[model samples]
Target: MGATRSHRIPRRAAHPALAAAIAAAALALTTACDPVGGLNSAAVAVTTDQVATAALQHQHVDIKWLTCTAHLDNGPRATPSAGSATKDVADVTCDGETKDGRPITVRGTVTQEVEGRCVKGDLTAKVADRTVFRASVLGDCTAPAPTTTRVTPAPGGHPTVTVTVTVTQSFQGK
Candidate 1:
């Protein structure tokens, strides 16, 4: 009788280093390939409109605008230290009753700046006189730097090419 031999299958060991690199690459690729969501653009623009309309209809309109900023002195490897920011918000609450107790209020917000540079978009509103209310302002100032990729020239006499890209939003808001 002939002897039969069984073949064994070989399994490859998982490399954590390779896995991490792949994950990072995937994250970068997804970010770079993704487009800015329209919903967010709508949100930024909508905030302005909400304030504008509220000011016009409400008796007392309180207008608030906040400005925030984030600075990074280090690359991805190190944590960044945040600096104190100046207030860019303006609060204007229109009370229908003034010193004489008349009725009228105008609430609104204007585009602001961070450390002196204009940041958030424009906003404005007005309400009937004699109305009373409070206002609030809020903002964030974290701007993400664009990611770049360098390409090497094939074998020909080609120069290196650098591409500017952003995978995900550096900042977000409600």
Candidate 2:
């Protein structure tokens, strides 16, 4: 019987610099794909506007010329409970006029989830001195983002003012 010989293939170790570069690339890809982690104050502001408008429309209010602004509350003072994920809370305020020429206002705080769609919050809508709508929205709490129109004055000495308006379609929901 002839002798059988086995040939072993040696494995090469990855260089330290290559490993570090791979790690950095992985981290960058992860951060870029993570919607929750990439949410900034400007994005939160837009989300807040959508949420507030949805809340108002849910109450059958025909909102016009709505202007919304948001402030993020993820500062050092914000602390989540143990075992709970850190949440980004945005304080939102919207002001506009109703179809009937009455002033409408929405005040609330909203939180957007990681799915890039789910938004939950507590909102209150008031027409003049009467509170028309108030609730803790669980899901489907987003509307179309508002649009801004910049009106530039003519070559005269007039000033330029930027205006943002959100006009929601009339909703017939009780």
Tens digits of lDDT, candidate 2, 102-124: 98777886665322223456777
What residue runs in model 1 are displaced by over 4 Å at the alpha carbon? 1-46, 52-82, 90-105, 108-126, 137-174
Q: Provide the TM-score for each candidate, comma-separated.
A: 0.20, 0.49
Which candidate number maximizes TM-score?
2
Candidate 1 lDDT by residue in tens digits, 93-119? 222222233333334433342211122
Give the worst 10-residue stretch by lDDT in candidate 1: 1-10
Clashing pairs for model 2 are none
- How close to the true structure is residue 57 of candidate 2, measured as C-alpha lDDT? 63
Candidate 1 lDDT at 119 equals 28
Candidate 2 structure lDDT: 0.47
Off by over 4 Å in 2: 1-39, 77-85, 113-118, 138-174
